[model samples]
Target chain A: MTSWMKKCLVVAASAAMTVGMTAIASADDVTLEFQQWWGVELPDGALQEIVDGFTQESGVAIELLSNPYADTKTQVAAGAATGTMADVVGLDGSWVYDFAKQEAIANLSELMEADGYDDSQLSDQIKYEGSTYMIPVVNFAYPLYVNLDILEEAGVEEIPTTWTEFMDACAKISENTDYAAYCIPLNTEAPNGIQNQFSSWLWASGGSLLKDGKPGLTDNELLANLVDYFKEMKENGYLSDGVEAMHEQDMVNEFENGRLAFMVDGISHLTTIKKESPDLNFTYAPMPKADDYDGKSGLDVACWGIGIAENCEHKEEAMAFIEYMMSPEVNAKLSQLANAFPGNSTAEPDYSENDELFLKAFEIFQDGYAINEFTGAPTAEDLMRSMNEQLILYFDGDTASVDDMLAATQEAWEAAYN
Target chain B: MNAKLKKKLTPYGYLLPTIILMMILLVIPIVMVIDYSLYDNVIANKNPVFVGLSNYAAVLKDSAFWTAVGHTLFFVIVSIAAHMIIGMVFALILNTRYLSTRTKGIFRAIYALPWMFTASVIAITWRMLLDPNGVLNYFILLFHLSPEKVTFLASRDIALQSVTLINIWSGYPFYMISILAGLQGISPDLYEAAALDGADAVHSFTGVTIPQLRPILISLIMLDFVWTLQQFALIWMTTGGGPVNATETVSTWIYKQGFTKFQYSMASTGAVILLIVCTIIGIFYVRHQKAEE
Candidate 1:
């Protein structure tokens, strides 16, 4: 070999040796293997970057695995039942309750304390059975998405915040344009655009599917009100001729193309709307007022939280990865990526580029309420989902009566809760 | 036969690899699917709880299951009828000698284009095309033909018929191609003899073409009937069994119940019922035809 070549070879060997040592340190030290269903969220090359960054800061080489929502839950349930789980998990909010009930999660209170999170900063709303089982990563609240074009076509100046005003607005919107006020979700499960569209109103009307561990059947007044309201919305031209038949994307297409006036959507839909048709005129507002708060504003929170699997071999590293994800920089980035907002309020992820309409969604959430503030489980939600299947007809004007629906809903809830 | 047999043992030894592969790829999955149909949950865990006929009973009890069955039966009957009638009609058109032979070939190829498209893309195109504010409706409104816009896919009463229309559109072209190939295979002497005897167009078809195409038609009907039972794409893309069970086919309902509602046992039960119903119909049709032959 030439003298110069020999010198270069030695330098290359030293660099390779340094890389080898770092890799070994990563493997041996506290490398945590984290699995998330959000493999989609990682983009083409983001996983490697996230892993490299996590390793550089903490000396822990992170291994990330991903699957879809259904597959992940099934796999996790099976794994936990058989005594195997990843160090960290990116669990959906609805599925977390079942996993927690099955004793699949690790308590993260101390980890949060170490990571500089406190109750004053984070909501106790995430606590279950007197323990914090997860760290809130991202959250989206259901809100009334109004196409300002439709409102203007109807000559309406403002979107209503209360139930009576919302109906009045709906009537006006229908009169002003051929647009249906809302759509109905036909299926018992799955994201039916129409059904979700109406759920916010019932929620805003000072009513819920459950009022304690029991069904909402006992409250004749609340039951009488919501069912009647939905019936009225259906009987009038506020809802489409038969919205119960439309799928989720149909509603999006309708709202996107200005076929309908208002849609109930989550914060995640904001990015989609902005990107899909940037020029569409619209705004996001708070869910209509439910009677319980009387004049107060509230939201139905759908927050995605991260949990540590109790079966994980590398708890500390996993905890570190979770904290890193919640770090202001990563939090904001992931939020923007997921079309959701940061769960932690201490550090606001960058919202500098948002127009007033886009920024106003987060502002509406400032006074938002949880879907079920007390319980962190998905059972009640599932229980309510079964009854909510009837909501399509409630929005379609074919319901026999509001009393009939309330009775059916109360019966379904009773069976579910029992 | 000797080569295939020899490949398995003599040359039949060469076929050993293929048999092993078939067992692994086809037989094993079929067996697993059957086993899963008998069990409660076979998705996540390799082992499943044996529920015997409970799943079957649940499926039988479900109103949606019956609705799905009715829809599937409806689609199969309509699609098969359309496929046979339209296919035969196109075959006749393609058999014409008025045009040059190459022009007939071109027309035959053009008729087969719908079959060439993937069922999914065909379904999605139809969905976009049929939407109330979609291209078709926009034009319909432009011409002022219909007083009101039609929600062909959005109304429960019409959603099934709408999806059936799309399925028939995709399916008939395929049958047209197959039956046209059969038309090509027929002896020219037979048609010439019938024509020399002064047979009319209808007479030539009934005496020669109809009798000759019987086996192909029956087989096509049987195969299409079974396949149509499993047509999830068209209905799923467009209606997804909504507007209150108007478009709920057996396969779609099985998927919705299994995946969406997480009712695996119930879904398996639905599948078994569909399988049994199709199998029974197939056997009856085949045997009745065999007896007649």
Candidate 2:
């Protein structure tokens, strides 16, 4: 080899060694991983931007593991089995109890106190059995959507606030227009889709799927009334003929195409509908109550929360990262970026100032009618899932009767919980 | 070590990697599943309490398990029959000497197109084509055949058949290629001999061709049976064991139990049952092969 070439090689090798040693020396003392299921969040790259900002402030590099919400729990379970779980996992607020029961996640009571996290500032959905297991991250409410053009064309001057009037309006809408009135979720494809939508009707009817930690399927008269109402709607052509196989996305498409008059969807869908159908005139309304039931009720709101895994090595560092993410300024920025509600009480979204459907949705959401029924009944996940599977059968006219569905569901629920 | 001992161990050394891989991938998972099936292991429960054969007993007694089995069997039987019939016809058509080499190659590629696509992609395509207002319904209406719309996948009585048809479409290509290979192996001299004996085409096909293809058919049928039993993605992507579990197969049901319901022990019990069923069929296939020999 040439002498100058050899000398250049030696110089390059020494420079590489110095750079490697510097990186090793400057490595953070504790590196935490954050696993979340918001890969499809609005304002793409906002999550990574927020994480970068957090890293800059805390100097504790956080690795973000993103997945879809449907597969997040399964991934977490597999990770737990292999002892490679992420330090912080973003979970559905409804699943806090399930994870707590398994002891898969750590109790964050001490960390919250140490970080001066006021529980009152967060939503009630993150608490389980008088203990805080997760800190609320994002909140969403499912409200009814009404096509104003369809209502005006149908001569429906007033929006229905009771089940009787609601059914009457549906019949009138069908009579006036060629489109159906409502897209009942006879086949939501996903259990959560049906569970979240059904809970609204169940709550509006002054009933719940569970009572005192037991199955309330057969015991609740309002549930029977709810089933009868569903049957009546189907029998009267108020629902689509293909309702037996319609999923949430299909329903949204139908609504956008002017084939349906109403649907129950997340407030985040407001942005999607506006973008997809720029000229469509649609408005949001609170879920209606039953005629006999004079109580306020709304759909169960689904929210996201961050929890510390039980096997997390850097609990203090993880809590610090979470504290940075939940700071009022950062939280508000995230809410604005993602078009989501603020997770902290002190950081309210400015949607109320806008003269749009979102403002009405925000009003209805905070009007005290919408309760976090998912948290109200810790066992609602299993109970409602079982009901969703069996009740769809009844709705398809496969089962003998609503009575049979009630009996079978109550039996299955007893077997499951017992 | 002695030369004889070293020689004996040499073959095993060559196989050592594969043996270890099988033990890790196959044996360990089977053992874990069997162990899990004997315990009450909900995903939320930190510790699994031993329940002995109660999980198996529960599975045996559950009516839903039987319904899933029945649906799975119906799908398998119908799909396999359609695959064999259509595959044999296409194989025969391609095996004909009258066809040019380029034409044969084109036909083969056309037949193999479905196999090139993933099951999910095929399922989504079929879903769109079979939707209530989908292309098929559009054609049906254009012809003014039926005054009412045909709900192929939404109807309880028709969803299973719809999914079965899709499975048949996705699976028939494998059988066609196998049968075509078997046909190509049969000597042309045999057909000449049969012609000399005044044996017609039908007699030759039934006697010579059928007998020569027996072994290949047996092996392919057994493999097809097992594959159909474990089919998941297509049906899951399409019906999701819904329209009231009318299309619920054992595999989809197992997935629902484990992932959706978090009933790990129950799902494991179902998996063990599937394993036993497959093992029994495999043993019978081996015995049948021996009997044929």
Candidate 3:
């Protein structure tokens, strides 16, 4: 062989060995695969920046596996089924019960105690069978969004605070204006519409959906009143049309385009509404309550919850990442970026520089206690869907009465719960 | 080994890879699903109990399952019938000698446009077009057809029909292309012979055209039946089997059971029921194909 060819071969072999060793060294470093829907929802690189910060501080890398919300649920469920779940996962609060029952997720209480984590600082932790399975990282409260232009055009002089006043305003808006007075998305495709928008009315009136941790629809007069209120809206043409096919995004779009006067929506949408419709004059208010109610209203809330998989190889590292996310400063930063409330009781997001509507919503949030009965409920989506179907029947006048509707829903929920 | 034995085994050896793939991908999963249907709380519970035929019994007794069956039948029948009619009409139009080659090409491209888009795009596009405040409503208002907007997808009365229509629109192109090929392959001599016999256009179509297209028609119907029976994405993205179970086909019901409700055993039971129906249709289809051959 020629001398120069022999030298070239030796140089290439050395380079290959060096690259292989580097790869092996990198492989040894703990890298957590964090699957979530937040990456697409947040500002580009915001989640990545948070993870990068953690990596820099803790010397543990995080691989973000992000998909859309529904897709994420499916992927995580599939992963759990196959015992291949990522080290860290973003959970919907509704999924906690099923995952815990299946033993797909680790008990966070044990992990926290082992790590000496301060559990008292956490605002909400999803529990199943007396064990913490997931911790909420951020919360998005559903508050009523009012369009000022629509109110003025409809000659509504005041924002409604009670059921009676709200009905009067809706009637005025329907009779005097081209736009609908209110919208309640009843789409069963993503049936959370029922949980978030529809049932919030009952909650806002200080009503309960559970009786001793069981379905209470049949005996709950407040639920009947809520159903009657919506039925009346449908009859008066005050409710937006085509709601049966409308998802949350559709509801948001209608409000953004000035076609809807009032809607209860997630606070996270404030940023999108501000950006998409810069000239939209809108304000946030607590969801209107029943005329006779004087108790503290329960505002509906959804959260970006986090959990560790039971199958995770690095439980300590996963817990560390969760702790990093829940730390006061980082939680506040995440809340601000996501336009949501911090899940840490001591962490307060600075809304001074955010959209004024966010600050208003935060004030409204403080006035009411956050409540979502579906969280940690078994087959929550199915329960919501059952109620949604009954509601649709009631609205269509196919069901005889609200009592019958509730009775049917109660039966369905009983079947599901058992 | 003997030379004759080796020769006899050559074809089986050639098919080994495909047989193994089918065993792994198709046969094994199907077997697992069937096994799951016989159990209670299969995937969601770590220790699933074998419940015999109870899941099947539960599904059969459920009113929702029957409603889904009715919806699926309506959706499949109407979709297949419309697809055949529309496909045959377009195929005949394109085959007519009156149109120039260039014009036929343009028309064919236009006719085939719906098939080019993905299900998601088709669903979103149709959703906007059929929305209450959408262009369709705008046109209806302009023409004073009705005093108010028509909620095409949201109305329980019309949601099933609307989704069926959308399915027909997206699916007819396949039928049209297949039938167009069948038309081109038919001997011109038959038509010429019919013309010489003083056969009118109607008679020629019935006697010559229909007979020649019979095989293709049967094939298209069988194939389209199977495809439409399993239709999920378009309906899911459009109405989600709603306005309250108006469009709740079996496929959507199975999806809700498994994915949304985490009732994997029930979902498997529903799926097994669907599979049995499809397997029956598939047998007929295979028989028809073999007869043609």
List, for all models, the DockQ compared with the true complex: 0.20, 0.38, 0.73
RMSD of each: 7.3, 4.8, 3.8
What TM-score does prediction 3 earn?
A: 0.95
lDDT tens digits, residue span A1-418, model 3? 8999999999999999999999887666889999999998999999999999999998899999999998899899888877899899999999988888878999999999999998999998999999899999999999999999999999989999999999999989998889988888877788888888888998999898999999899878888999999999999999888999998999999999999999999998888899999999999988898999999999999999999999998899999999999999999999999999999999977777888778888888999999999999998988999999999999999999999999999999998788
Number of clashes found in candidate 1: 25
The CAPRI quality class of candidate 3 comes to medium
lDDT string, candidate 2, A197-254, tens digits: 5667777555777777677788578888888787788778888667666667777888
Q: Tens digits of per-residue lDDT for model 1 on A70-173?
A: 46765766565445877888766555555565567777876667766554555433555667787677777777888898888888888877777778888888
Order of all candidates by lDDT, from best down to worst? 3, 2, 1
Chain B TM-score in each of the candidates: 0.87, 0.95, 0.97
DockQ of 2: 0.38
For residues B176-274, could you state the per-residue lDDT of candidate 3 as single tens digits?
999999999999999899999999999999999899999999989988888999999999999989989999999999999987788889999999999
Best by TM-score: 3
**i-RMSD of all predictions:** 5.3, 2.8, 1.1
DockQ of 1: 0.20
CAPRI class of candidate 2: acceptable
TM-score of chain B of 3: 0.97
Q: What would the TM-score be for candidate 1 when compared with the true structure?
A: 0.80
Q: Which ten residues in a row have the lowest lDDT in candidate 3 chain B?
A: B39-48
